[model samples]
Target: MKPLLVVFVFLFLWDPVLAEMHKKCYKNGICRLECYESEMLVAYCMFQLECCVKGNPAP
Candidate 1:
């Protein structure tokens, strides 16, 4: 029972985390150009741009 509960919890959170990767790409234009291997880079770049700049997107 405990194991099943743990699995369920993980599954619920896993989908969101995975889905966010694609969502992040849409939020940033560069995502269309990025490959699977470049996902982390795109996401990091987006996060930094969001934090570093005000309203302006990263180039």
Candidate 2:
């Protein structure tokens, strides 16, 4: 029972969003976990992620 309670507490405290919080990009943009369709990648955000910025999206 104690182990189960510990596991639950750990799970509750662990958050993916908190781990991948928004980081500042180099240019006028934001480092994101995932880039939007209208946003263009400008630089590296972190491992597997890149910096993103609002640009004239391709047609």
Candidate 3:
């Protein structure tokens, strides 16, 4: 029971870390898309590519 509780607590704490990592990647992709003005299409394409690579379907 003690080991199970420890595992549960570890997993609970770990989830937010994983979520933040994904959020950072997604935000970086958005920032990249926003940074350039003339090559908007290219920037958007790159962002989409990054999202695909990261397995984030709704970014």
The lDDT for every candidate, in the order shown, is 0.44, 0.72, 0.41
The runs of at least 3 residues in candidate 2 whose Cα sits more than 4 Å from the true structure, single-residue gaps closed, are: 1-20, 57-59
Model 1 accuracy (lDDT, Cα): 0.44
Tens digit of per-residue lDDT, candidate 2, span 3-52: 99999988886565345447566787886777888888777855566778
Best by lDDT: 2
Residues 1-59 of candidate 3: C-alpha lDDT, one tens digit per residue: 99999999999987765554344343344322233333222223322322212222333
Clashes of each: 0, 0, 0
Model 3 CA deviation exceeding 4 Å by range = 25-59
Clashing pairs in 1: none
TM-score of 3: 0.38
At residue 27, give the lDDT of candidate 1: 42
For candidate 1, give the lDDT of residue 53. 15
What TM-score would each prediction reach against the true structure?
0.42, 0.53, 0.38
Q: What is the lDDT of candidate 2?
A: 0.72
TM-score of 1: 0.42
| Candidate that would win on TM-score | 2
Q: How many backbone clashes can be found in candidate 1?
A: 0
